[model samples]
Target: MSPKPSRGTTRTTQYQGNPRRILVGITGGSGVIYGVRLLEVLQQKEKDGIETHLIISPAAAITIKAETDYSSRYVEKLATKVYRFGNIAAPLASGSFRFDSMIIVPTSMHTLGAIASGVSDNLIVRAAEVALKEKHRLILVPRETPLTLIHLQNMVRAAEAGAIILPAMPAFYEKPKSIDDIVDHLVGKILDLLEIENALFKRWEGLSYS
Candidate 1:
């Protein structure tokens, strides 16, 4: 468990150079690997002064264990801090969590729907809601194969509410040479939206609306 923030005080990232803090959430979905990969990259960045806080849904925990054999505890270790699903009282559940942004990787449609509807049944939803209310960066990465109308509607709502609707869709425009390359490309897009410089993938060149 991460140390709770002191009441009525600003909680800051524990790094020199005042690195930015980001909140990453992993929900139950097919592309759970994206969340893990993002964590791996962010942890590496932590050594260079970047900090991260994370929240993992029970479904995400199970999916990681089943899909990748990554011990949930070890995966949780990647973050500067981790919060449980039901811990609505966690610092991030409030607008004062002092995070620069939040991203929900492999966001389950169910979770997305609840967030779109302003439902805060769990810390994941609550944290996202807080991010919305606080006008902080909020990104959602859904990996669904075929989105339904309801899913589209929910995504539209979240997008209209200042959340970045970044689906976990990777493109071959850069001609990825490997599977990891594709993953890195998608992560690179997320980092770009967050205004974080990343060397995850090559940027598109020679592309124009013309």
Candidate 2:
């Protein structure tokens, strides 16, 4: 967990000595914007030694086109490296590949179930499994609503295996004025899980009942 910053405190974007390698997996889910926004933020942190390795699922490619105006190629360019979804032979699929964390933004229920069941038929799931086996941070940002019992069970199973199931639910405490504000808040929460300091959204302060 990231230390809560005091109100009005400014965080420096100083470059840390060692490179922080993060593996990102985007799946086919409704809220594809979350994944895109995360990539944009990470791209901005490139100077801070944050290296992003991205893997976009096939279904996600379709979702990207359907949901956002940005091209899939543009999204791929944001990452330090990109991997194919079906390439299980990729370095990320191996437990030996050293990475700080793996985040699956907009994780589909299908992908969640696959990870929970220890099924690594694809590179994304394989990388997640490796993250678990290697004791690396694995954050799953599920975007589905009205989840079924199976979905909840899968989430529990994944959580038991050391994966953080962070849903794409934004808070209203900050009094968001636009959809971008809401998205930023959720992205900030995800950054907190990685212990990455950010001011993407205003932090909650004590209630002020004047």
Task: Kindly give the number of clashing pairs for every candidate.
Answer: 0, 0
Provide the lDDT at 97 for model 2. 82
Sliding window of 10 residues with minimal summed lDDT for model 1? 2-11
* Model 1 pairs whose backbones collide: none
Alpha carbon lDDT of residue 49, candidate 1? 71
Residue 93 displacement (Å), model 1: 0.7
Question: Candidate 2's residue-wise lDDT over 123-178, tens digit each?
Answer: 99999998888778889998788999999989888887878888988888889999
Give residue 156's lDDT in candidate 1 (0 to 100): 77
- Name model 2 segments beyond 4 Å from true: 1-18
- What is the alpha-carbon lDDT of model 2 when measured against the actual structure? 0.87
Candidate 1 off by > 4 Å? 1-18, 207-210
Candidate 1 versus the native: TM-score? 0.87
